[model samples]
Target chain A: MLMNDKVPLIREKALWMRRTAFTMVHRAQLGHPGGDFSAMDILATLYFGVLNFDAKRPDWPDRDRFVMSKGHATGALYSALCAAGYFPEDWLQTYMQPKSLLNGHPNRNYLPGVETNTGPLGHGFPVATGIAIAGQLTGATYRTFVLTGDGEQQEGSNWEAAMVAGHRKLSHLTLIIDRNRLQQGAGTEETSGLDPLDDKYRAFGFDVVEVDGHDHAALLAVLGAAPASKPRCVIANTTKGKGVSFMENVASWHHGVPNAAQYDQAMKELV
Target chain B: MATVTPTAAGLQDCRNAWVATLEQLAEADPRIVAVVNDSVGSSKLNSFQKKFADRLINVGIAEQVMVGVGAGLANGGRIPFVSAASCFITGRALEQVKADLAYANFNVKLVGQSSGVAYGELGATHHSIEDFAWLRPLTNLTVIVPADAWETAEAVKWAAQHDGPVYLRLSRMPVPDLDIPNRTFRPGKAEVVREGSDIAIIACGTTVHLAADAAEVLQAEGIHARVLNFSTINPLDEAALHRAAATGAIVTVEEASIRGGLGGAVAEFTSANQPVPVERVGFPGFLPTGSTDWLFQEYGLSPEGIAAAAHRALKRKA
Candidate 1:
């Protein structure tokens, strides 16, 4: 059983991840706020609870690999990395600044935690497959997890990777779909319905599981469960803009940074 | 140089040379392996698959997965030569090549078969003329175009031994060998096939033999021309180019698009360092369907056409 003492601490860590996400986006004045906020809790659970990585040995071959397939939500990843002590927390303030480590996209060249340079849709899955395949070859127990956005799933490449993952029987790899219903322009159903997403993944030969994305207990339980045989896929059903009162489930916040008043309100709500 | 035997025999495609050399390399070294996008027969890698069954991983027509698997194999301490049709390998998996091979700095060797107009009958849809233009901008990726079977063999051996990202443009067209018997292939160096001071004919891949034949014609006409076999496109031998520029006139030729092929590379070198009368010869724009030979001749990538360009460049030279 998971230590009960760690449960309260995970909530604190997740709240910190949320605050860091808001602060970085507010500082950069440019970020995918909706996706970042929706996925923050999940990222926190992985970094704090599941992932086995040390800031000192960032490139350790045996360490568990994490790829942010929804690379536009790099602000969330940067904040998580900082909270994990990979870098200074103050580094979040330099988001998108000239010569700063934070770019519009996560560059593996500049950042220690980023495994691949991703910004284009459907890019990270294949790369994560590569990392996992490497582990299989080396007989290492390291696991690779990739998180992709609901809109980004429309890219044909993601499906292509999904098919390969199943065909290769990559039980060491896990694909987490941040199934937030809303996209940049409209709700995913209104834009392009992905209602049968769970079935689609199951048909693709993955062992599929559905869970509430925001609930820490459910996310931890589902994410920690090892695959029985085939590669596992967790459909993290989520709201587009989660946590903040007015922004939740809104599509406009996909890339819209909160104004000063909204920022204060968001901070107050988080507190 | 290989002299064609008068005996009636079927010509061997250079891709066969690529696979044969790959198998030979694999037998000698356990690390050498082949990666493909379900293109085992297309890339002439069936012999390799037969010999090393488990090593040939057919990624099932997914170019992006093919590249990623290559990077993964490289990460697993295997020297993977990822083979695929040039159009899909370079076009579909461009970002993967940039990230996994170039950015991640893996030792994955990308082998792009049937480059240029080799897929002539398949129409412009199958052509890979823009491969050089797409790959030249990226750092840590060496691009090489071998002129004939001999060069292709030498290039494959060199790529297997050399540790970094390399792209070998293995063509399907047949040509007489341009290298001396048992000559070692050097990375990032140019080979001066024929010597002349009036004009320098710089070419690569199928065009290297064309450039040599063009120099032969120029010699008969009392217009001497130097033929430079530019096998390595990137990390170009600048000193040799500067020496060629001193000859007053240089004509660059290739089967790729004129905008970013051999001509563009030479022009970029000369414009900044030593400007001279340089004539660029390549596919000028979009082309229609035909056989490889017909397309090459139609686009003036032939010996006679190169000779004419050299003569014109000589006339334009100060």
Candidate 2:
């Protein structure tokens, strides 16, 4: 767990990550900024305070693995990876550009910190479950973590993986759902209600926990806990766009890029 | 009506051979693990599970998770063999196969058991005639349909040693051992069963034996049809196709659909490279309920049907 003296610095880093995510999406003129902002704090806390990894040796055998199941939020992941020194900060300038390693979705072949290629929803969760299974078989102490969007849970594959993970009792695996409530076309409630989400995970045999997604200290505390006998599911309640006022909780902002004025105002507000 | 009898003396089930080879490979390598979807009995992995209890991962009927788990195991430096029924593994988890294995280029072997109408009486839902069509287009995937027990064992051994994704299609149907013992299985290479000049009969999996029988029948009639067994489908042996084209006529056969199985691959290769008189032999649509033998005969997948197709191709030769 992070010490009290370092908690403020981690919060400050999370704020910086939000700014970088916004800039990447704004420059690309394309990206899921809403989910990016929503999951920024969780990503920052996992990379900085929780995950046991080495940026220099990304493929370290015993290192903890992190998979971003909501892969549309590449901006947030790229910012976190850069902040963790996985790549030079200058790489951020070429996000989504032609010949840039930074694609709209993370490609594990191109990126070092990326554990696997994920774009299609409900895929990373199962892959993470398999990784956790491997960790168990090898008796390795390393853990596996995956982050999924609230809307992405509608995919049936997630349930398939959830059932197996629960049945296998992969205690080393942690699944974090960025519950922003809004999806692409409408709110998750209007589309397909996932209320009682914590209960649903608990039924799937997970040790469920809910947290304020933006609170860095809370995220660190919850994510840093040791594994129990069952898989852990962290339901991070969040606003769709955490730092931007106009985009926050707005359903249309799920993929809506801010215009010049909106972008300017958003940047000023973040500062 | 003229009735045709299978000429091969002894027949062996490829599934048994696959399991035998899998056990040998697993015993040799500790990194080898079997990931199944509660298909241990169907995949002939009961012995493997019993022997390597800790290594067998049965995900209990979840095909998507089974494939994903295989990919994850591969990432953790374990060679995962994902075994399941072909219909569910390929049809239900097509996206996982595409993303987790092929596109990601994971070191996993997908063992699709009971492929190509092997479960004929169970109905069309259980038939896996579309596996070739489904898997052929995916890049970085080596698609193989071994003809018999020997080929299946060799292919399984090759897949375990190979460092990339491979789909090994095994059948519940018993097939004659066409391959010589200790022959090395190479991907993208076709084995010539017999050489001739009138017309070439190219086939794979269940139809390879039919092609061989057809070649014998044609020889008695003085047709002298060439026989080419194509175990590997995706990285197709174009060189062999060109050699077959020299015969001026070709008849392609498979136990799968004519759309994208061995027949489709042969047509695609021949039409573009060498314009030859070609006749394709295989099932066209969803198979009706029947015994495996009845379905094979009904769909013109028999030896007599293949020989007739060869006769038609010989007529078109100019």
lDDT of each: 0.84, 0.89
TM-score of chain A of 2: 0.97
What's the TM-score, to 2 decimals, of chain B in model 2? 0.95
Q: Over the stretch B207-260, how does candidate 1's per-residue lDDT look in tens digits?
A: 888888888888898988888989999878899899899999999998899898
Q: Name every residue pair that clashes in candidate 1.
A: none
Q: Among these predicted structures, which one has the highest TM-score? A: 2
Model 2: per-residue lDDT, tens digit, A114-168?
9887899989998999899999999999999999999999998899999999988
Give the DockQ of candidate 1: 0.42
**Candidate 1: which stretches are off by over 4 Å?**
A1-5, B1-12, B24-32, B72-78, B103-106, B161-163, B181-184
True contacts kept of each: 0.36, 0.61
**Ten residues in a row with the worst lDDT in model 2 chain B?**
B1-10
List DockQ, one per candidate, in order.
0.42, 0.77
